[model samples]
Structure formats: structure tokens, C-alpha cells
Target: MSSRFLILFCGALVAFGISGCGAPHSPMTLALVTQPTRKNSLVKATSAKVSAAHQRIVRVEEVPNRVVTQSGLSVPRGFGVQLLAENLFVPRRMTFAPGATASQYDVFLSESKADRVSVLRVRKGRVVSKATFTREVSQPYGLAFWNNWLYVGNTDSVVRFPYRRGTVKAAGGAQRIAGLTKGGYNQHWTRNLLFDRSGKKLFVTVGSSCNSCEESSPQRAAISEMNPDGSARRVFASGFRNPVGLAWQPNTNNLWTVVNERDKLGDNVPPDYLTVVRQGAFYGWPYAYTDIERRIHADPNFGARRPDKVSETRVATVPVQAHSAALGVAFYPVQGGNFPKDYWGNAFLSFHGSWNRSEKTGYKVVRVHFQNGQPTRITDFVQGFLRRGRSWGRPVDVQIAPDGSMLFSDDSGGKIWRVFYIGK
Candidate 1:
């Protein structure tokens, strides 16, 4: 056997505590193999094996499915996961509408497949009543509440309806604010909407029509912005494969988004990412992928795309695992929050899981640790959505509840799950 393979084999055996080959499976054996050595190639090989073994150990230690919770999900100790609502038809995005009382809040959910936005009044931890807020929406995927108006993003246009504190139905006709590219039934047709902190501008995310092709419309593969009244429509940023979720940092005023990168680039070639959205920035889409190494491509349709585009691409704040299908991103606000103090300022992202890859990845929620308003690392916060290579739920969007708990939507299972810290 080659020395590299032998080293890995021996390391695995030692990691699993199996006695083997002339050398005893002891700490000394592990130290000898992993310690810095004179040979450069040997050192590289040994270091890789040791690192992988350490990662395996960490994964095993962190993800122990011994205890199943009320939601039939496995969560870390001191955390609680519960099904808040279920039996909905393809729930996508969720927002809190103003309630009648100070402590009460109405949760608005977009039932995408049903093309309607549903409302449920949740007081404390109980869902009081449920009703259809509006059935006038068409293939509604994103909903946002701003300044007494509820903006609904459909497949082709963004519309706004008058909203009151305690009302359920619209009193007036819907005003179409902006027109979006709705290429019939493509790979990414869902439109996500977000309003700026001041509610002066509304941002909408339009995904690329095809997986890896130059889109005919400039609006596709771009984040478009307009006045709250739906005027002054312009592409804010371009070249994103599928920018799904949009969130503004509480104090920083920085707009961030989780983008789903293109696929078919091997199992781990291109990584999906989260990054601050800069106006007019072009992220590499069909022509390039920005990762550890920038991969530039030449397309027959586009013909000799600019290589400089790769260098011009903004690097991701956090490069998530490829094919993970990162969908939702929401920052845990530090002020008046109910989560643990350590979770303050961190971002929670939902990986909608993988489809085309041979091995499944990302059927859970991950926390991106932040220090001084910048992302440091990613760690699994909620897992066990996948069991025995089968996934029971695919998390799509994540939002922070009024009480500081984390709320995420699972479209596959038609459920909304609430996760919160229960420890001191």
C-alpha cells in the first residue's frame, strides 16, 4: 500500500481504537504519525489524515441522535425543538404582522403552492386562530410587512396591500409595484422580497432562469431594488446564481444574502455562500465560481467571457458546503432577544438540502459565528433532518420570533418548527 493510504488507514484504525499492524494502537503511535516530521510530503499526508480524523471525532461527538425531542428532531442539549404549525401547503417565507395588543403578534405565512398568505395569531407560545389573510396573491413566495403595507412578491410582480394592526383581509385593490422576469417554470422561480431599514426602498431577489446559463434578462441572476411605491426599478447587484434570503444587520445597516451557487461542478467544487450585498457588485455566476480558487469558464453561448470577472467577484463572507442549497439567513439581534447571550449577533442559515449530488448534505440549520460584525466560522446548530440517507424535512427559511426564539419553515414536511434555548 502507498504510504499515504497506509497512513490514513492506520489513523482510522487508531481513531476507532482497533489494534493493528506491528505498531500498537496507542497515543504514542498517533503522536508519531501526526507530529511534524522532516519529510515535507510525509508531513502533509500525516497532517491531512490527522485533521480528517479529528473532524470525524468532532462530528461524532457533536451529533449524537440518542435523544429525540417533541418535534421528532435531534437538537443539542438545553435546546428545545417543537412543531409550531403543520399541515400547511408548501410554506415559504414568514413575517410578523402587528397585533391588537402590545405583546401579541400575528404570524403571516406565504403558502406558495396554494398562492395565498395565511395568518395565525400567536400569543405567548400558543397559536390562537388561523385564517387566510389574502387569496388574491399569485404564486406568492415572499412576504414583507412595512409601514402599514404588506408587500407580496409573486412570480411576475410585486404588489402591496393596505394592512392594519388587527385586520386579516385587504380592504382595497392590490397595487402592482414592479414587474419581474417570470420565465415559465424554470429552475429558480421563487421571488424573495425585503425592504430597507428605513422602508424607503424595497429589494427583490430574482433567480437565474437556468442552472448555469447566461440569462437573457438582466434582472435574472440579480437583486433588483425600487422605491417603496415600486418606481425607480434597477438591478442592484448581478451575477448571483440564486440569491434567496435577504437580511439587514441591526446596527450595521449592512445588507446580507445567502446565495445558492450553480451546480454540476463536482461534489465540492463550488460552494454556496453568504455575503454582504454591495450595490452594483457582480458575483460570478455562469462564467466563474469564487471559492478557495477562482474558477473561470468560457461559454459557447457567451463566447470568451471576461476572465477578470473572476477576480472582480466579491469573496463570500462564509463559503458553505457545495450543493447544500443555502436558502434563508437571519441575524440574531442582540437587543431584547431571548436566546443565549452567546448567540447574539450570529447568523442562522437554513440549508434546504441537496438534490443532484450523490451524497446528501445540508438538511439542517447552521450558525455562522460572528466577531466584530464579520463572520468567523460555521457550526451546525440544528441537525437530524436526515436519517439513513432520507430527509424528513427540508428547511427553507429562518426568522427570529418576537420572543427571541428561532423559527424556521420546512416546506417538505409542511411544518414550521420553533427552536429556543431552555437552559440557564
Candidate 2:
């Protein structure tokens, strides 16, 4: 089973489980204010009325799974540990390198399982080369490129390695960055890493250890910043259940993030949000949530009495939809006079599909329309991740390649997809 078939088949299985529930949406015409119907559907990609503002929407033209491989650089020895491609793209398992200690990270290792973090060289919408770069760590996630180096975050720590751009192969093994607090369940253990535009500082996010419990200190479920070479570490902000994605605004260079809110609030009480992160701000997690005014509403679960030991930060800026599980954010810098000047400043984010919801949400990439440092609206850019009432792909992260094309990662399909705009 190739990656494509696996995605399609799993999508079909999910659809079969919920086919009799709803109807898809139809095409639309622009108006003064376009309102999207609150309903789930199984519609074709081109027919969806989701708008992209001035820019045209580019859908996925091709998605091939398990096509990525390793650098042929002789991974640690293991017998009967063949790289089975079909088992590679499943959603539940954590893919890791051969001979890697399972205890090092939370990877999917069974009689049938494959590794994550495969590499590929793509040009003109086709994969020219491929490799699977596995490391001796637990659940290698969150990849970022800065100054010819590739930084990846594992369950416990962040790893860095020298990378030659466009060469789809690892330059060498990884070096560890010190100072990260671990001890969380497997799901909340994901550590997302980001770099500032000037490369002066590195930002890392660690999710809350429990669903809605008071943390030991301020660092848990908060964003932290440090010097580029891993010095002068300090908590940037707190009160996020899971801040998975971080990006710098292209025009202002201000930091922003997409947070995954806590679950079990009657399925729709609190909404997941995207917000601008300030250096000393807090957005109220575990003790408060977003309200109509976007301020922190006192928590029905835990009252706001613990402000001394745990901070009760105010809730400010927030994005659309709750529990959307918005993960990866990528800013598209205007390149060589191709895109409009306004586009140079905007950002693109992938909501990697939602789980534990009454009705499924996210499963697509959205554009954050901003002006003077605030969002005007959140518009849909890519749809069809949730197909035929099921998710064919759950986008995890987005990155801008050296060539200016957008690279989107789907951990659900175990594949990385590329999208570029062409004049119609």
C-alpha cells in the first residue's frame, strides 16, 4: 500500500463510519460580506466557496506517500527492521529511525511500523530525490531551517544539525541544545521550535503536562525564548494548553502562535485560537478561556484564585474557531515583485485537523489577514483535507522553501506536499 492509497483508504473508512450525517456546501459568488454555513460536507476541492481574498487558491495536485527515504548513511543496525512503506503513513504511530532506542522518544514501534522525518528534493511539483533521516531520539518533530542548519524538536529536547539547502540529505548527526523540562504524557510531549527573523533568539513551546491542572511552575504550557546558541533562557509567556505553531509576522517581526485549547469542555465551550504573543504576556490557560470580547473568562473548572503561585494572565487577541487544533504557521514573503505588497506581510497557517470534537473542524490551511498588527479576518486557503466527511490528510506544519514555494507536512499521510501559485 502506497501513501496515496493509505490516505484514501483511511479516509474511506472514516467516511463509512459517518456517511449518513450531512451534506456538503456549494459554489458561491462574492458579496459585501460572505458568510459560511456551519455544516460539514464532502465536496470536491474546486467547488468549495472558501475564499482566498485577492490571491487564487492552490489545491494539492499530487500527494505520494512513503516515497521518502534516508541518506543511505548506514543507520544503527537492526534485523527484521525493514522500512515497510505502507505502514509508514498511519496516524497513530510515531515513526523513528532504525536501531533507535524506543525509550528515547515516543515512536510507533510494533510488529509493523515505520519511521518519521523523511527527506526529499522536489522541483516543479515532482520529487526528484528522497531519503529518510532518522535520529537516536524519541518522536523527532518540529523542523525549522535557519542559517544553513536544520533544527528539530524531540519529545524531551531540541536537536540541531548542519544542512545544505536543496540537497535532501543530512549533513551529519545532531547536537543537543541544553535546558528543556520534560515529563508529560505522549500526546502533550510535542515540542515545537522556531527562530526569529534576525536569528538572534530561538523560541520553543512545551505543552501542558495534564489536561487542566496547575503546573509546577510558569514554564509548563508556555512559550519560552533563548539566545540563538541556547543561552539566556526565559519564559516568554504562559497559559496556553498547547502552543504548537510559532511564526514571526513578515512585516512587523512580532511573534504569533496557534494554540490547541484544553478538551472536555462539553465539546464546544472554548475555542482554539491564533494570537500575537508578547514578551511578557499571558493568555490564560487552565484557569480561564477566550470569551466574546476575547478576554480571559474565569475558568469554571479552576477558579482564578491562584494568581500568586500561577499567573492569571488576561486573554487578548485570538483567532477563529475553537479546538481547531491550529498547528503550523508559515509566512509568505513577497518575492521579486511577484506577489502584491500586502501579501508580503501576511501569514499562512495549517490547522492539522481536529480531534475530540462533536463536529470535526480544521483540516485545512488558512490565511491571516492583518493590518497594523491585528487580524481582520481568517480566510480558508486550502480545503479537502477532510474529504467525503473524513480527513484524507491532517496538515501538521508549513514551511517556505528556498525557491519560495510552500512546503506543507501531513503527519497523518506521512508525506510532505508542495504548492506554488501560477498565473491563470
Candidate 3:
């Protein structure tokens, strides 16, 4: 299609704004085939095609950051943490390109502070080259690829540019598709983007403007969807404070989000959360919250604004410890992954850490376990970012590489860490 016709076609589809093909990065598009449904919490390892070597046991180990922190980095015993690239200017979210192989892949990471996105070429688990994909962006944080175009969720808008698999640099200028509320209270300026399973809808996370107050715009404090070209915008879900990450479960295909809840009101009153997001569902943010035990309660200060909504707020599937600052979420592949079958369907999250708490919290990586397609619990996965209440590196985002290794970005250190299993 001609550029003009393609633009109009996309605009017609969205019914409001204009857009282009982009990545949803949704569940199993990379293909983690599931086993038969079972009542047990864990999926049965009955597939002969799955490698049994991944079943070997492993435990967390403490080590040093090697350069910056000088403090120990926590990782599993069998896995090694390799600093892929450093000196990046606030590297944030990341996405592996399509058509990647077990040994070679391309990761596009957004350096929000630098106002650019860069691509890292990895071969055999090591970074071979680094190059800029695009620049002159406004705090570009969220990234996705669909068909032949790449989408970026900037502070003020959702934009897209032509991108091809293995292409290190952008081929053309970006086309702004949808306008967004820019710069929320504090650090809510990061806009994360995701596409639904069928790529028919684009999900953009727009954070609330304040610590805990009624929002003035419909776009604030909500996840909204529109056509690929940015038309027919509508709120997908509401009442979330800061949902930094969005991932679809490989087995059950449910949309999961790790939220950063409101601060203040004491140390452990309300918890940050990992929850399954539903269409039209409202999660208590400025109004109320779902506790660690799965019980719902109204927000101490704002509950009276809408008592009905506060009382009716949906409960979180799993409540993380308060002030953890959950930022990114990545689900492990259930099939065709280098890790053992037991590691399949698990989700990894980045704790950007906390600032307001007197005693800081959440400066590490965590694993969210799933059984029978539902999240069972959250446990420490990678650590060492925090030592004696002082942190040198703050993890921002994480992604599973084509080789089944775990890669995370630490913005404070301006580095990326790759952890891969080496077997028992």
C-alpha cells in the first residue's frame, strides 16, 4: 500500500487517530506451547519434546556488580550474570526482534534519558555490536514491533516508524499516531505499549498524574486501546497508579501487570501488585487497594470520593511487598526454551527500587511462579542491587532472549545484565 493510502486505511480502522503495524509482544507469539490442563498447580512435564536437563535444581548466589556497585549481585547458582553493554544513557524497556535464533538476536532498548533507542546485536550469548536505531524521541520508554513497523510509547504520544527484522537503524521518520497526556506527577512520564493477542488493538499504559487523586483526563491512570494507526481510542481498564509492565501468560493467555502502588500512609499498609488485567476492570489506586491476603480495602484518604467504586475495586492476583517499585515483567517460554521445563511459564519482574521509604525496598529482580497458568507466588530471583540499604544499580526492565537467557537493564548503572543457566 502507498504511504498515503496506508495511512488512511489505518486511520479508518482506528476510527480516530492514525497508526502503523506494531508489536503486541503478547503471549506465545514467540511460541511457548503448553501441556494438557491439569488440576495441579504446576504443569506436568509430559512432553517428550521438552529437554529434561532443565529440571536440575538451582539456588540464588550473592556476587558483586564487578564495576559500579562493588556490592554483590544475586543470581541463581547455575546462572551467570554477564554485563552485556554499559555506559548507556538510562536504558529502560527492551524487546527482541522477530526471527531471532537461539544463538543470534537483536534487542532494541530505549534510552529514555538520552532521547533515543539503540539496538544490541548478540551472537552466542555475547554482545557483538551496538548501534542507534532511532533518536530525537521524547522520553521513549515502551517499545513494540508489529509486521514491518516499530511502535514507541513516548510521553506525549504513541508513534511508529518502519522497521525490518535485523535492521539496526530506522529506515524513515516516525509518524505520530495517538496523543497522550505527558508528564504525570513525579516519574509517571514513562508510557509502555503492548498489542493484544491478535494485533487488532494496541494497549498503551498512561499513568496517573498524582500520588493519589482523581485524574482530570480519561487517559491518565488507565490503559487505553486503539487501532494500530491510533484511531478509536478507548479506555481498556482504569484505577491503576503505575502499571510499568504488561505480559501475557504463555499457557492461559491472560494479560498480567505488575503495578507500582501509591506511596505514604505508612510502610506496609498497601502493597504493590501483580494482577491479571480484565477489560473494564478497575483496580484500586487513588480510591482503594487489594491487600496481600487478597482482601480489598478503601484508600484511607480518597475512598470517600466514590465509595461504591472503592468497595467494588477488583482484587490483585498477587500483592507484592509495599514500596517495591515494580517496573517490568517478562514471562519465560513454556516450550522451545533453553531452560528446563520447570522454568517454563514463569515471569520475571524488575524492582526499580523505592525512594520515599526511610528504609529502602525493591532494588532487585524477582521471579513470579505460575502453576496451571495462574501465578502462585513471588520470590527473589536476582539480587545485589541493594546492599545494607544502599543501592548502586536500579533495575528498570527485563526480557527473555531467544537463547533462553534473562536480560535486564539497570538505568542507574547505565548497564544491561544477562543471566543464563549453565546447568547444575
Q: TM-scores, in order shown? A: 0.82, 0.69, 0.83
Residue-by-residue lDDT tens digits, candidate 1, 268-361: 6467777788887777676555442112222222323554554455545556677888999999996667787778999999999999878888
Q: After TM-score superposition, what is the CA distance of residue 196 in candidate 2 from its true location, in Å? A: 1.8
Residue-level lDDT of model 3, residues 106-175, one tens digit each, is 9899999899999999999888999999995799999999879899999999999898767899989999
Residue 256's C-alpha lDDT in candidate 2? 80
The candidate, 2 or 3, that scores higher on TM-score is 3
**Ten residues in sequence with the least summed lDDT for candidate 1:** 40-49
102-194, model 2: which lDDT tens digit per residue?
122112221112425555434433554446555444566566667777667766777777766445456888778755667674378667777
Clashing pairs in 1: none
Better of 1 and 3 by lDDT: 3
- Top-TM-score structure, candidate number: 3
Q: What is the C-alpha RMSD of each candidate to the true structure, in Å?
A: 9.4, 14.4, 15.1
Separately for all candidates shown, the number of backbone clashes (residues 3 or more apart, or on different chains) is: 0, 12, 17
The most accurate candidate by lDDT is 3
Error of 1 at 269 (Å): 2.2
Question: Whole-model lDDT for model 2 versus the true structure?
Answer: 0.55
